[model samples]
Target chain A: MSTPDDTQFEAAFADLAHAAELMVDPVDSAVIHGRVRRRRTTRGALAAGLAALLVAAPAVWWLQESNGDENDPPPAEETTATATPDPTTADESAAEPEGGPDGQASEDVEDPVLPAFGDLVGAELELPEFQPDGGSLNDACPSGPATLADGTPEWEDGQWYMHEGPVWVLKVVHTKLEEGGPTRAVALIGCMPVETMVRQAVVVAGDGAGGWEVTEEVALGDTSDFPLFDIAPAATAGVLLMVTDTETTGMYEPVPVDYRIMRYRTGSDLEDVTGEAYLLGVTDIEASVEVTEGEDGTWRIELTLTNAGDHEAVGFQMTACGSDSFVLEEFDLPPCTADSEGVAVYEGLAAGESVVEEWTFTPPPSQEWSGDEDSGMYLLGDVRPTTYSAEVFVYDPDLSNNGFRVDVTPEDVA
Target chain B: MTPTRGTRHPPAAEQPLLLRPTLEFDDFYAANVRTITGQIFAYTGDRAEAEDLVAEAFCRALARWHKVQDYENPTAWVRRVAWNLATSHLRRRTVAQRFLKRQQEVHEPPPDGDRVDLMRALAGIGERHRKAVILRYMAGLTVAEIAHQEGVPEATVRSWLARGKAALAGRLAVHDEMEER
Candidate 1:
């Protein structure tokens, strides 16, 4: 057998990468933004000067509020209430009339009981038209090929082993299209073996006479990759089926990425209403420079750095390039220098933070001075105007605002 | 180096909150979240966990945007933070216990067999090798970029990539044989 080349290896890795990309669920930026805001609020509260006083005041109220709010029952979608509560009566078959005004009681009166969602669906489950001809659900999931292509009977014991796990009925949700309308019962029912699990949704509607019938059976075909298992009532109407993809790499952590938001109305098929998820977070540092002429025949160079984005700019090494030229012109300020040790000279800038530095330099006074000399100061033979530009270099993510330059001309000098 | 003397202005929070800028952070977050999350997901094999880790890293970045924004590559910093968080979280969780619990509960749809095999192989490899492969292929980072971010020599990154590929191939080949049989 020939060995795979580098190109093949690269292609295979790239393919895996692409598949992983496709497998990821959309990220809700708003959710992340909320988390950040909450963290910041907590942090700010901690940093407040009156933190102890504030905490003392809120602690009492929070404890009382927490008792009620924290213990509140979970939302309706997670509840086991399979059928909608009727406003007027219980079951017509079992419910008894009220006692007479004479305070006499009826002995035969008994409240009605609702049937379990699983029992109702399981007793009426029939393979939808979309499913291939197979054994009844009571037989459990169909066990495929008893052997392998190599006639190995042990193949049945391999990864594809299909156990005869019982038919499983998942969550049942009760919702209605409009107020006072008949409540709809939506649930996910399926047969789970070891590997291949079949999923189907049975939607039943109340006839308002305590009678219920399966109005629509949705055939959710082979969900071996991304399973649409959980069912909940949609915010507006119908039912919402959530797809959860499990990550079985090294650990068995189940990652729930509300991957798809599918809506199934009474008569309509499953519709994809997935909203777009995008990224939201960036760094921006604004830089500006000012050059002004002083009455003392000197040029002033000012550089200002500001953190204009929501994030704080940290450990940025600010370099005022072209400062060495100013050093040759008898500048009152020392040359802006960065050490070889890579220290962050400017430190950091928080959101809406700014810093300013200024330097003043005097040009050559006479034309009799030598152009080249042993001294560090430059000697000019003429008063011809010279332009010195200063620029800032920062590690800002947004390069457009990272650097700022300002030109200072000696022509303005007297 | 000591910070140069400069006139410091009040923080933006002191001014009207509306005057603070946010568009840049939003744009940056929107641009890199998907790719970064995907890369982390490839490494961890859990998309939801990866997203949470990435979001956390970005949150830290925002908190210190003044400092992080000045880094040579802010995205790289975010990725490293996320990878570190993933490692720590994985270590904190009891994998064996979770596996047992998952087995008893209603089994979720396992990822594609090949994908599962690939992830299993990745898990068997060295941590550095797995990170290198994921960042290189999934994040589409160049060898030099990976080396710089990983704080290693480019040659070392190349070696890790080669060994990672060989390990994956060997494991996948065994899987294929078993499947074929």
Candidate 2:
């Protein structure tokens, strides 16, 4: 009752079961399954791009499934002979947060005078040079929960974007060892905010035998554990650590000193790779300033603000602070009180929206003698040392990337 | 959210039908993913590609499990979708390879043994015949199901299956003879 076709088909089916055994085991399949499930939940940046944009659910699955080993463009892992057209635009898997040729342009729309989110210029800050082969991230992803609790040098920074969706692998600097050993990848991950800091570093290197070897992890200043931001790799031996010294004890204006240091051992020195600034986080607000002096020695300070991030920037405040000399000499205004007459606040903006506001103050009555007080310009050698500099602050709970000095007129205003 | 092991099932009206399929789908996934993956692997010739296609097929099924579960054979649905994913992947890769070959000398990754033999045999049998054989053996699709998917007569499908299998058997016999020598 068995035809040649029937028996052969049975044999082939059995052979296929054997082949399946050769390919992916139950654990491997579960890993793939978990990844798909995780991707559905943690698609921070992927949710906006082509993956989420596709109308067909199957297309998204196709793109996700096709993502092959790290190093080659996913979707186009192109192992399938029929050539599944990768739905991912920009040449790889859903163009996530970093490293794209067109990255700066997106960040450059620059929201209104918002605080400088510390030159987080962006992950795409380093490209073409870094994404060698464009396929590593597909494999470089962490296998389990992305947590900094262990600080284990695990490849995957198992954190979700804002803990909402999409595993945000925010910053990864991929470099090979000196003599071309295994490729080394150091990524700055932001998942859960412990004390408002979601920064952690996980280093992974090639095992020289095709698998990845996670090497090191340094975060929040390991010792102080102050939430670190603007983390990027130092040229050679180690990484560049930048943190807004938030815990700088009481009193005195929080002179937001941007601390960026090369964190490495003595024998090994950090080198400069890219001159471009790679920020760990992104800020929604952008600030710009223009100063115009009126006929009566009065000056009109104009400020503008814009919101370019996905979230709404609420309670926008632009505060102008100054040293004693500049406060009294440059603006004839009352002695600079903290945020009194020195601050301009506005209702926040939704993404892509902008707002403008202005404040006017007259020059100091006595210092107008120009020829006498070191060019009468606030302070000279200590030139603008006493001059009022305006800083914009959006009510970010973290306030880490939310404070920046706005440029005022008279010096380098043009 | 999925109900835990001991959790009581809510009354029919209170529970959404969509949410109810999780357990069923899990069972189905556990039962079929391995089989479907092997089937896809044999058809695609690359383990990673096959795995990807299988996962993609399952992902699509998960999205529409409510309807898929209603079908007489949900696994067949996954197989069909997975086949599309694999073929599309292959079609894309072929174009890239052709383009690369035009510009420079391109080397292909070595195909595995049984898969290579199967691929060559399928090619010898011709596209339509090969599709029927694959749907029958690799995807576990019955002749009528292949006929339905291919929009052909059942007799035509059976004929393709017969010819494709004969071609495969001939090729394997030759391979076996060579190996023995």
Candidate 3:
């Protein structure tokens, strides 16, 4: 009789690997070979053309230099979309308060009440003991740009390799597991002004070695509005609160720079919320909705909005994104008078006050959307996605809000 | 993450210089495609995804074949790309899962086949240890080669192997016992 031992572990793994080998078809290089060949030919031609262009570029530049008009329209640069005029984009008379690299709230009001940073975060949220000393590209962060203990080049190199362009490690908050065996830290990151206005929430996991490993990074928003950003940890075990006074731009129409705060949970779920919740320094706007089937065979979607802040709610706009099985389409909103921007505006709600609104989704709505029948890319394994989402963009100077959605489910009336 | 482990990745500008595929690359692909696919398949229990990721990694290598062939082990370059693809694929899946859940958390087909016994056993160990085992057993890389590829110490590779095998042996025995009963 024979017994399995250390060698048997390799043998056992080898057997299962052999079994797994059969599960996948041998990767065919023919398609890849042809694709590479075509790309190479295209590249060679492009290089030759670029060489010719490069040779003639100096003459073109010389001619343009001599013929330069002092006031030729600058390149079609993207003008900031913030409703409140930014000092960077405004004339001297329209100058706003100084904005930090992290995009803190810029005060323009004669006596705008600005809350202190310490008051922004929750009582339970604790700042890290070893905070990064500096907030510039050249500054060394004592607790960040996590290096792996394994001594990999990325670990050994002091560069914050995960970020592009000049970046600042604004905040690094961690929760250590028993005697600091391993620590999980969330670093608030901001790129130089040249980069996009995207602030990042980077989660660094401490490897057993002295160094830290960057496990996750999520881009929260643009800097122009999040001028005053606050973070709340321990609010959710796997969730991190990214409270910033930002706007949901890319809406084409310009809305005021209302604070659009969101919750960033650490787990793998894409982002847990859309523009559905807000918790700013002094402004906390909570929204709840009820979905029910009506006697007329239509779906009733009722929305209740509440102000949990010290200030009164001045303006709030509601926009809905509807999708047929596989895509989000412009919502077929209920019959209601629209503002000049064509959005449904709810104005005037006092602090600690709640207001209710309702909308109805009629019957005869198609739940299934079709796609390529042959490949079945549309199928979420025998089912198709048929849901709708509604997001509210708040228009308060100090606060912002988000919205939620409803879907046809067995438990809920479809 | 894995791609940056080796000597700096051949720069993006170098791809155009390799205007044509050499017979050397064809020979290299012929020798290694099967083994790399098997390794990735074991790494990810999904057959279709393994094939797709492995193919994508090769496609990248083929584009940079001129410089890639010059690397100490071009196969390792493909492996790194495959591994990165796996991480990115998982991240994208997580996003899609959330979207689908919000859309309608209804019927989703269970994965097609039973995952390999080795994957279940490997799950009990840490990620780095599991990768070491797969690199050793499935990719047939030597301990020194894995150490170089991962940019870890040779002793670290050996330790990972010892711990991984020890953990795997017990998991496999328990799995076998349960299957028998």
Of the true interface contacts, each candidate retains a share of: 0.15, 0.19, 0.33
Model 1 regions more than 4 Å off: A1-4, A44-414, B1-21, B94-116
| Alpha carbon RMSD to native, model 2 | 27.3
TM-score of chain B of each: 0.73, 0.71, 0.70
Residues A185-266 of candidate 1 have per-residue lDDT tens digits of 5545555544545556666543333234456664464555556544544444455554545311111112312245466666
For each candidate, report its DockQ versus the true two-chain complex: 0.07, 0.08, 0.15
Judging by DockQ against the true structure, name the best candidate. Answer: 3
| Cα lDDT for residue B105, candidate 1 | 28
Q: Which ten residues in a row have the lowest lDDT in candidate 3 chain A?
A: A381-390
Tens digits of per-residue lDDT for model 3, A199-265: 4555654232212344655444445544324333322222234434452222222333444345454
Q: Is candidate 1 or candidate 3 better by TM-score?
A: 3
lDDT (tens digit, per residue) of candidate 2 on A269-367:
443322332221223455555677777766666555666554444334443444343442323332233323223334335567777656565545444
Please tell me the TM-score of chain B in candidate 1 relative to the true structure's chain B.
Answer: 0.73
Lowest lDDT sum, 10 consecutive residues, model 3 chain B, at B102-111
* Rank by lDDT (best first): 1, 3, 2
User: Which of candidates 2 and 3 reaches a greater TM-score?
Assistant: 3
